[model samples]
Target chain A: MFTGLSAFPLTPIDEKGIDKRAFVGLVTRLADAGVDSIGALGSTGGYAYLSREQRAWAARTAVEAAGTTPVIVGIGALRTRDVLNLAADAQSAGAAAVLLAPMTYQPLTDDEVFGLYEAVTAEISVPLVVYDNPGTTHVTFSDELHGRIAVLPKIGSIKIPGIAVEEAPGRIAVLRAVIPAHVTIGVSGDWLAAGGLLGGADAWYSVLAGLFPETVLAITRAAQTGSSAAAVAASDRLEPLWALFQRYGSLRVVSAAAESLGLVNSPNLPLPLLGLDHAARRELEAALVVLGLN
Target chain B: MFTGLSAFPLTPIDEKGIDKRAFVGLVTRLADAGVDSIGALGSTGGYAYLSREQRAWAARTAVEAAGTTPVIVGIGALRTRDVLNLAADAQSAGAAAVLLAPMTYQPLTDDEVFGLYEAVTAEISVPLVVYDNPGTTHVTFSDELHGRIAVLPKIGSIKIPGIAVEEAPGRIAVLRAVIPAHVTIGVSGDWLAAGGLLGGADAWYSVLAGLFPETVLAITRAAQTGSSAAAVAASDRLEPLWALFQRYGSLRVVSAAAESLGLVNSPNLPLPLLGLDHAARRELEAALVVLGLN
Candidate 1:
């Protein structure tokens, strides 16, 4: 199930809470575009800023709206009990798999993190994807720790942060040799998806793909078919957008992009996290058009 | 209101929910021992690991148990709406002040952090303490950011993380110069409390003082009375315990210490945060005894 382009859509928020209408439309669009999987509620989905009930509804909605496309729901929370409840919610909602980042409040020890995975993996029925997004979750997983969690039963994939394009091959090889063959490696960081894909990552767990599925699918397909030049060209074409993602973070950049594209309501992000400012928003809108992503 | 030793006790939890009886006993002990204030749901209280209802209950219980002693309730949450709800709950519960750490899932910018304080400070009736806890919150506040937020209406204090004892004098002096005279500067990090107090800090925001009130009170009282030598000596006596705190985090070390001292039920911490292992427990018990903190 962990292959090709997996689109992680924004779980848009309005005054009421999860704007399910906007969320469903985003998921349905990804499925209709023929992306490999729908990753609902990754960091892009603002999973941490939600309540258990809200997260459960979003998980169920993503699975229902994705139709034939598999849905991988992000079920990360600060507490193990909460993560277990979320995992149960996602699995019962008919999610194809579950994504878990070792979300932290107090800094975690390697042992605590491993214990968290062990406890959850022991209870859940579906395959689990180990989400390693240090920028958001603030928990760094060492290669040895990754190797340990990767072998646990139901571990379907490991979504790793991007390495430099030049270092992707050797780095992925080093990681690939340590973990089990059955566990696929999905690369995140929209800007680094090409290097990760060409460097032999099995899937692209993407943020922009949620809004612009066709654009990323082109890169994924070219990489899958061994058209390195085509993949690089496609990725290079979106450099301007990637620059904005690097500058404002893909979540904020895409929240603005989605609003500008009329895919979601403005002020869509959960509060305490504002949307991009006027200049960044204008720049993003122009980039979307100049890159022909509109 | 934010001065002297503010004892931050654990809001102990059990199978059903908050162990209110245990929590009340801890708060009562702090109040009875003549602590200057009670910090209800600080990081040591596991504020990040609770629901709005649970936090509200904890806040009410602490204020009620603290009697006339001022109680500062921690009102940090990942969402601004939740923080506002928590701040309102704490205020209604008769809390004297609120502590807010800029909690994050997506790492926040300085502007966003400032915006959070601005938004919350506008609404809360009680004074607010800016909790600059990077270890748990993973969001660092620059001195410039602290200076900006300290001027916001209702800002009573800023609780800065500890620096080296040698650096404390100049560090506190620098910060003291920036913030308004009414806004007290409190220093956290149990090991550095002495240096902080002697270094011209207005208060010691302490974890150890929660469980061992008399122990840290001696140091606080010594510092308050201008007995720098006595304060240093008192802090020195607990050097072994501080060694454990530095080795394991103060929260974990204190959780283990609390359990050993029969302050609460075993496994007092929130889920996913296990208490110290057997060896650490054994070491902790020995340290408590040898240090005469038993």
Candidate 2:
């Protein structure tokens, strides 16, 4: 169900709770820009840090705001029961699909990993996206496991993390070969989106799309049409923003960029991850000007 | 406030939830063995996988069963507020101290790391142990951050992950030099316990101690008395068990060993992490026999 340029918005939170209005506005903008899908409460959305209630609210708010745009809500947690609970909540909140990441405190065996997604998929009617973000989840989706998960009932897509810009095509090729033809392969990580699209990923599950859906959609369209020059130019234009992503994570940089562009209020992200540093903020401002984001 | 060999029990859960009787019995056994402290919900206890309510119950149960043995509760979480909430729960449950690991979803800066603990200590009356477990938390405690955390007002101990068995002594030496003398330096990860104790660490925050408290105590006492050969012999005796640890993490192996010894019922650990594999079980059985645990 998740395809093309899906925008994963940073969940903007204020002291009172999730800034519902800000979140709704963010999703509405993406929908207005005609993005393919909306992924709320993904890593960029801080699903891991928010309470269950807040996450449900995030899903509901995004879904209601996006209207016709399909919304994929992240349902990953440290426990299986928790993931199942969140998956059920996502369905009730009208999410288009629920994303599952094998996020466990202990190292999960291949069987155990499959069983986690299988258990959740059994309960929910919505398609499940196996989020293969090894960096955060600490679980590697071996090619074999990918094939195994792909065959399970309700397994719709596998969201692969993007490799270096140049390596995306090769990574996509290997994944496409292993996974069944019907299973959509989406690529995440804002910096990896252009490469992922050019490399033949079924979709770009993007962070930058949250702020600049038109820019990401342009890159996706250019790459999909085999317009290599156009895709390269679009990718090069965002190189400065990608530099900010390298210095800090996309989540921080994206939040700062959005704040600088006056697209949203200054967000108070969950603690232990502070706002962008002064140098980072200044760099973001310059990049925003250069990219005409402001 | 915390020192010596601290027994960290795996919070055995059954279908009915935290096997309360089994949990209390295990802590009682540690107290009966005259263990210095009971670390009820450390990583080995599966704190990350537990619900807040379950964790509070674990703390209260261990503290009540521990009698005079000081009880330390693990209060790590992805968000600072959740950590504070858990810390408060720990205090109300009569824990002697709270262990805080910067268990964040995103990479935390040193300032952010210190801020998390600082926020917790400001509210709680109990001491805090800086849990520096990089393997799980994904946040490294630079030596500078370690020194800064050690000097915090209510910080009592710093539980450092034991490096490789051979590297334990040097790791302990470096940590000891940076952290103040008053703040206890405790080493966890059973494989490095012997070397940690011998290298002048104030305590061995141990996993095996939860089951074989006397064995761990024997090793600790041996090291404390300058009996290096005896300590090495004691550690070497458990090499087979350590091999199991190398294969599967301590949480799984320790839970399996406990079940094999009939110390607790066969635990239904939180999913995505299964019980020990057959090979691991057989190896654990042989190790138990060798160690006279069976």
Task: For candidate 1, list the clashing residue pairs, or say none.
Answer: none
Model 2: per-residue Cα lDDT at residue B291? 77
Instruction: Name model 1 segments beyond 4 Å from true.
Output: none
Q: Which candidate is the best by TM-score?
A: 1
Error of 1 at A60 (Å): 1.7
- Weakest 10 consecutive residues of candidate 1 chain A by summed lDDT: A14-23
Q: Give the per-residue lDDT of model 2 (tens digit) for B1-294.
A: 476789888898754588787888889999999989988888888899898999999998888999998999999998887888899899999999888877866777888898888888889898888888888877788888899888888999988887676777777788878888889888887887888787778888999898889989999899989999999899988998888887888888888988887777875577767888887799889888877878
TM-score of model 2 relative to the true fold?
A: 0.97
